[model samples]
Target: MTTSKITAEDVAAGVAELVPDAAPVEVVRPLRQGRSHASWVLESSRGWLVGKVLLGPAGTAGLERLAEHRRLWQHGIAVPPVLAFTESCASVADRPLTVFEYVPGVDAEEALPALEPAVVLEVMRATGTALAALHQVPVEGFDDAASGLGTISATWNTVVTSRVEALRDAYRFVDDIPAALVKTGLDLLDSLAEEVSPVARPAVAHLDVYLPNILLDDEGRFRVLLDLEHVRWVDPAMDFVKPAMWMFPDQQSWAEAFADGYRAAGPWPACWSERMAVATGLELLTGVKYWTQVADHAMREDYLRRLRAWVRSDGADHVWSAISSAT
Candidate 1:
């Protein structure tokens, strides 16, 4: 079933329908602007809350994210308590919408000023620990529904090629992007397809772990993690790149903190760090696709800065070289 377009009033109605007794007093956009879904701040007599209305039809992907959110919360990870989920095809807005207990906090993007080297290390470690914990979650009879090891191996090619075509379409109208970079990036993605996929061991992971998705409370502690839209049972290595990209920004020092954190939390297979180079390269190639295709002008510019930083990073060349060598 396809999710219908959502409006502010539709969101209000959904909230009222789900929690029939509660009255929504006001609605405001809490997030600056995101491409995935519309996020908002909802105020009610009971308390403040945030709501996310999926952009397109509610599909298995959305359901997966919700399920993962619930699962992680039950596992003691910091995340907003899910208050209500409204799903019905007959509703004015057909897409499923969820309202969450508004965890009072600031996104790491906004809180970056308060982040110092020490705090960055701590947060990086915490993120590594949290990711390790997430990867340990079990799937019951539904294991067949999740992608298999072969599927994971194929995703690198499928997602990259599809996104590259989108990039070509997007840039077909714009002239400023360098053709050489496009070709080189595409070649890199093509080369990545031949590298060995990680061992078939599967675990749950929040594949989308951008800094904006990580929140910190007023007390300077991690309050909650948001946006599990990319949740899936995949290789544990799938979760590492985004955190590294965010904390290290190409500086490999952050990897040490992450390693320390991951090890401190529990036993990670000894090969985890060994796989970082290839895993991170795939993640970077994905970023290239996103920046060249789907991202808005401002977002594209921001990503370019990060990309250049990565390219100039000390060990980044070594990472990319390893991936190339493997191919």
Candidate 2:
């Protein structure tokens, strides 16, 4: 909801300072503003590019995210390479600014709904394969910036528990969350947390993997991945959480196809079902809390509806279950 204070002049100055060679900025058109950052499509003498200005508290984490993007690119993930980054660009809204190579494509969120079912299946399968490659990149500690338990944790258990505890703590003050739902959520978290064993080894996970983060071309083929800011080292199953929750719950065949593609590339661990269930439950709880905090009643109500359904089913009505049944 925070509007960007960045102006065309600011963007031009940023381009001149950070990417002097790409100067003589011809166009600076604002793109959709995200929750934590404001972005613009920039056309310059060099070529087209995307510039992002970190907003609010997200400014401090720019360097760390830049490094993560570089790591993913080095490992062959289709993330756009960072061209230039600055921690403090006083002329550019006095916030951290990063410019990246502009990838030409539409986000799958906008493209998927219009595609033929068969093509949609192929896209989902390709997405599954792409995620497999992403998770193969080995990583050490878990870094969840939003956890508020610190930037990095030694174990995935710590991160997961911290998130559950945070939700439980919020239950006291968030009057919007139903008491019965909260109780069920807490109990489910405790039970599911126990069911999910520790991951053998951490791999890179795009913690936010919903349709909006996936890019596709004119022909509906996967082009590039977007939004590497939330990438972390965690259970590979965690990568499936968002898509499982938001992307494929109603699309059972898509889930099965994704599972097929994933199986072709790597081992589909037996624990995947439990892991996805618990992670999705926790994510729903977080979504309820977030929407309530932002006072978005419509979204809060939607999240509550989904959470209630999840609770009614005892967390079994999830994409993983759908995929398991079909497989």
True-structure RMSD, every candidate = 6.2, 2.9
**Candidate 1, residue 83: CA error in Å?**
2.9
Clashes of 2: 0
Q: Pick the candidate with the highest TM-score.
A: 2
Model 1 Cα lDDT, one tens digit per residue, 1-327? 234355566676677677665685367655654666777787877687776776665565566567667877887776678876654423335666777877778887788677776786666567667776767667431121133212332333343345456555655665567566555554554444334333335566677776788887765556666787667655556676666545555645556666677677766653443344445544554555556566466766655555454444421442323222122
Report, for all candidates in order, the number of backbone clashes: 1, 0
- TM match of model 1 to true structure: 0.69
**lDDT per residue as tens, model 2, 28-52:** 5776677777777888877998888
Question: Which ten contiguous residues of candidate 2 have the minimum total lDDT?
Answer: 141-150
C-alpha local distance difference test of each model: 0.59, 0.74
Prediction 2 global C-alpha lDDT: 0.74
**Cα deviation of 320, candidate 2, in Å:** 2.9
Runs in model 2 deviating more than 4 A are 1-4, 59-62, 148-154, 199-201, 325-327
